[model samples]
Target: MSLHHTASQEATRRTALRLLAGLGLYGITMPSIGQAFASDAPGWPEAAFKAKTQDEVLAALYKGKLEMSKDVTIETPEIAENGAVVPVSVSTKLPGVTSISILVPENPYALAASYKLADASMAMVGCRLKMAKTTKVIAVVEAGGKLYAASSDVKVTLGGCGG
Candidate 1:
């Protein structure tokens, strides 16, 4: 190979090595990054995720009952053409919302998604969930240490999660 070609290859090798070294250093320096993903991290509702029924999930997560509320709003398609990727969004006007959870009662696991919000954070969450069939999509919010819920029925034409 020509001398110029050899030099170019060496430069490329050095650049790649530097990039790898930088990434390694980043991983070593960021210790909390690992903790953020740990399943046993504080406040993670492990039992709730494993619960089968909505009542069980609520008991596991909140240890209290939820009341239907007009302040909690659920925005989802009335009919989902495909059950595999139904978009769902939840928002609440209730003050001091600490968490939001989406539940699909007919799914193998009742809890589709759950998010913990910071103090004074906007009480809104959006996610896609897989549905086994047509079912009511429930949005539960924890505000001021109380549970509030809203639900909307979504008809799925195509089955998702093996219907």
Candidate 2:
């Protein structure tokens, strides 16, 4: 067999082994992913997560109105083939950003996730959010005791419940 052909076969074998290992690890962790989050983090905002509508969720989380700011940016795929695991990242150049929250308007629960940051912490956060269907993803940043928001639409071809 030619050396080039042998090398290609070796690369394919390595890729398959990697995929298998990753799948095994993911399967082991899948069960624990639904476990309750245990931490010292105060202000869980349980009500916000239970809020059904975007307006109600915003009111539940923040005391004041949120300002749409170009300074805060939400990064998400324009089209997600699998809604089960859509990657999202939120960041802001604004100062004193204490918290970041992800919102999905079309989901049963409007508030998908939230993150807390301190004065010395970075103003950026990344998470994987499940979307039931195509919808708008909003990032809300609490900075300097004020609310700022940025949004982007993601088209989910498949519902996030399962395959």
Candidate 3:
């Protein structure tokens, strides 16, 4: 066989192996991708039940009963220009997460949102949220019959206030 042909074949073999390794790791990590059974209407509770102030929301969502888990992660921009439409995403590496919810305390309603998951599946949910002002955005994951949470701050800037 020609040297050039052999080299090409070798590169293809390496790429195929890399692809297989990635697939194998994915299978091991997210085995329950399509088995998450969540409620049709996993509604959020009243604001009083969630929190009022930003700190209160963080405390309620990420403290004591709501322990932060390494399996869950929340993503949001460090700075948001228009508080009316801030993008946020919640994702979990844990298996069998029944549902996930996002909450913003300073808003008119503290329970910003909730999302049900498929049975035996990992979930990654993204949505836009409104912030009355700079506030904490939290992700709460219901998995293995318990609740886990993660939180991050989103800085909202007015015309001259961010200075």
Candidate 4:
């Protein structure tokens, strides 16, 4: 083939190879993504929605520690339809939390939230949360070797996981 044609073909082949490689990588990662939820973080209770009260949820998330303070703030909608996917945000007006966690009492899992503090100065973070029913959502902040907590209720109607 002519030089120009040869160059054009080479470029096309390179692009095609890159696309296939990307797809292959995505396929390999698909299963592992779900694995992140395979095990609950340490210090979390091994119970399934056993928390009938907000304090129970906070205690579970904190795992018996009064080190938490009241600086942590929990944010969520006053109402929600699909319990499976809810938006939650946590912030601390005090200083910073070394970690943050979310919990829903009606789901099969009690430990619905967990986060490790990357920066001691980071005052806030948000996440898309999931619920199983109309339940209270709690956010726990671990800072200064203590656990501080806040909570809100979300009323799920349609249920996100098709309840």
Candidate 5:
């Protein structure tokens, strides 16, 4: 074959190899992509998220499977001067943690936030919660097919959750 013809054929071969490699990578990653979407599947617990009572929300998520644990720690201000922006942090030393959830019992909705965690992630999460008044701020952690909880009292001086 002529020099130019061989060069053109070599370029085409390179392009074909690249296309196959790309397809192979996509096939390998497709399952994980589907899993990510499933984790975020649309029918998010709408009724549970909207529930006004603490017991109702807990039943929806944990099915009443909860126990107080010393391994879980909840950090919040002893007294929140601004109820609109009260910072909170939760972490657990327990193994096999799958999720972390925060709840403010006195707020209009008891379930403040819920996080789905991967096995590789740290068992710690932080977020700000609004408080209508002084109340217990609870952290629920799911680990090894069981739910564990910790709570702290935060006194909110300013109105939040339409206090």
Candidate 6:
């Protein structure tokens, strides 16, 4: 056999071995990739994401317990030229924050985004959200096993979330 042909065959064999290894077929066990990055992991609030009203979402996520707080801050543009990509950020001075959630009451689903913070992690998060129109953007922070919230108004010229 030609040397080039032999080298090509060797390369193919290595690739096959890699494929098998990736699939955990060669006496190896592989973790479920889906489970590793699933949205349905433990403590995920599925019902809150599906809630249509802000009250429902708050209730589903925080058991209807929330208080207005000045320590929580919401930063967003007063006017959003594009509703499809409205930038929003949340930060809190409250100690022992465990989670932060963003809510848009006018959107199809009031819950825009939610995040869980690790112990001693900074109480801050940022993301883009779609808006249906001019609406209040609320940031809810969970600290010391209690929920506190703050809100700001954002006006959208073009409707996102199907207007």
lDDT of each: 0.79, 0.80, 0.68, 0.63, 0.77, 0.80
Least well predicted 10-residue stretch by lDDT in candidate 6: 1-10
lDDT of 5 by residue, 1-163 (tens): 0111245445754555566778776455335743653432222455567888878877766654679999999999999978878999999999988888898989888888888687699999988878999999989888887889999999877545555
Candidate 3 C-alpha error for residue 65, in Å: 2.1
Per-residue lDDT of candidate 4, residues 60-95 (tens digit):
444455444456677888887555568889898765
Worst 10 residues of 2 by lDDT: 1-10
Error of 6 at 108 (Å): 0.7
Q: Write the per-residue lDDT of candidate 1 for residues 79-140, one digit (tens) a residue.
A: 99688899999998888888898999989889998887877579998888899998999999
Pairs clashing in candidate 6? none
List runs of model 4 lying over 4 Å from the truth. Answer: 1-63, 66-70, 159-163
Cα lDDT, model 1, residue 42: 32
Among residues 3 or more apart in sequence or in different chains, the pairs in candidate 2 whose N, CA or C atoms overlap within 3 Å are none
At residue 83, candidate 1 shows an lDDT of 86
Q: Which residue segments of model 5 deviate by more than 4 Å?
A: 1-43, 159-163
RMSD of 6: 15.5
Please provide, for model 6 over 1-163, each residue's C-alpha lDDT reduced to its tens digit, 9 standing for 90 to 100.
1111245455755655576657656333333565564334333467888999999987777653678999999999999978889999999889988889899999999999998787868999989999999999999898888888999999988545556
Candidate 2: regions farther than 4 A off? 1-42, 159-163
Count clashing residue pairs in model 2. 0
Candidate 5, which ten residues in sequence have the lowest lDDT sum? 1-10
Output the TM-score of candidate 1.
0.72
Q: What are the RMSD figures for all models against the true structure?
A: 15.8, 16.5, 17.6, 15.4, 16.0, 15.5
Clashing pairs in 5: none
Q: Mind sharing the TM-score for model 3?
A: 0.59
